[model samples]
Target: MPAIVVERLSKTYFTYKRPPGVWSAVKSLFRRERHEIQAVRDISFTIEEGELVGFLGPNGAGKTTTLKMLSGIIFPTSGAARVLGYVPWERHAEMQRQIALVMGQKMQLWWDLPPYESYLLLKALYEVPDDAFEKRVHELAEMLEIRHVLHTQVRRLSLGERMKCELLAALLHRPRVLFLDEPTIGLDVVSQKRIREFLREYNQRERTTILLTSHYMQDVQELAQRVLIIHHGQLIFDDTLRALVERYSPSKALHLRLEQPADAETLSRFGRIVRMDGLEAVLEVPRELVSRVASEILQSLPVYDITIEEVDIDEIIRDIFAGKREAGALVNTAGS
Candidate 1:
């Protein structure tokens, strides 16, 4: 069975509108003009059990809103959604116990108390057995390497440590489904890597269905096998990361270190030069012609070392959002 099923799910927010004037404000007391904002448009998708999917988008793209609906935090304006075979908005106890939601910016742990104390509260709330709770807490804390600080106050913990503790809390119940919103946000590179490694291992061992939303491309690149991209409150792409790069990126990058200095004019014959600095140059060439162009450059130019690179995922996503590339075709092709 699918872990999640969303069909034509959408959320519209209604807010009062008023002109910037004292007279307009006074006149709006009895009657006010209301404006409709589509936070999430008609979007539909399914997530199978044990799949780790990446949810990607820029600011205000409805990524969090969709997560909220899936986690039963908010109600949708239209359509339907089921999480773990239960209507999420209905907030069934069984479904609630089987799923976990963690947002990096929000803290469910108390600030002044130690994390262990918070764990006690959560254990009671989740109705976890005593022996199971003890085993899970220590295991997660040891894996996250936060065991030494579990007794320390949460406010005294570093940002990375707090995030780890958050993960420990979320996983204490052994939830079958996990929803993470920017779980690595504001964390340093080392902390980010550790968390990613831990998540990858945990997913493999537990077969947990995870849906993660993050701005950091490395998080998606290293951890997600499939990606779902939302733009302007709509899902523009839904496919594997490799498929996304293959379909949307038309060119490959070539990095060259020359044995002799070559001017930009000399390199222009081979491909569009992305950067030219001293004897090192970067070029963008058509994907289909990369082999031919590289061969010609080796035969013609004074080349010391050359390497081919796929277009950066970050650049491709930026182009899609900046209107440098058309995503309408992608939506049509992906049946979004």
Candidate 2:
């Protein structure tokens, strides 16, 4: 069975739709206004054992909300979600034992106490075997490179150090599944890469299914084999990173340089003139029309250097959402 299954799972929050003005606030105070905001809408997907999936979207796009549901932190407003053959919202001990959640923005460690103290408390709460507990702590601390800061008060540690400790704390039980929400939010390049590498290696070593959400494209690009993109509380895409690139990317760019200044009017006919400088110009054109446009530009001007390349996934998705790139179909490239 799949480790996680979410079928038509949705979350709608009732929030007051307050009008702008002091008078409106006074009126709302007495009337108690409310509006239904659908945080997640009819989203359905299943994750297999040990699959690493990236949950991606802009801010307030229900990424965290979905993680909360899977981790049993919050209940869905409608539909159903099951993790490890148990309803997550029910919060049963059996389900809880198998999963872990790490939120980079929130601290689970106590500020007044050292991270070691926090780990001890968790070890007690989870009733981890004494030998296993020590083994796990030492291993994770060494891997996260926080062995030296283990005894330092959580409040005194730098943000990067604290984040690493928090991650270790979340994995104390060696969970079968991990829900990571912005696991490397504010860290520098080195820290972020370290976390990603550790998570990837840990997942492979233990067969731990992982669902990660992050704003950093590098995190998704390097770690996740599959991605689910949410926009306006809806799943806009669910496929491999390559499929997202292929489906939305209809064109490639052609960068050109000429011997001398070229006519601006002549350049417009070749393709969308993205940029131009003196005799050099770049055009965004359909991949199929690449040769045609290049030939036309060459015939029209004294072309010097020219190059064509496939568009990156980032720009392709941008055009797709901006109503520019056409997503006529969904192709699964998870293996690729």
Give the Å shift of residue 229 in candidate 2: 0.5
* Candidate lDDT (C-alpha), each: 0.93, 0.86
Score residue 168 of candidate 1 by CA lDDT: 95
Question: RMSD of candidate 1 to the true fold?
Answer: 2.4
Per-prediction CA RMSD (Å): 2.4, 4.4
Candidate 2 Cα misplacement greater than 4 A, ranges: 16-30, 254-308, 320-336
Please write out the lDDT profile of model 1 over residues 1-59, one tens digit for every residue: 89998889999989999888999999999789999989999888888899999999999
Clashes of 2: 0
Q: Estimate candidate 1's alpha-carbon lDDT, on a 0 to 1 scale.
A: 0.93
Against the correct fold, how does model 2 do in TM-score? 0.82
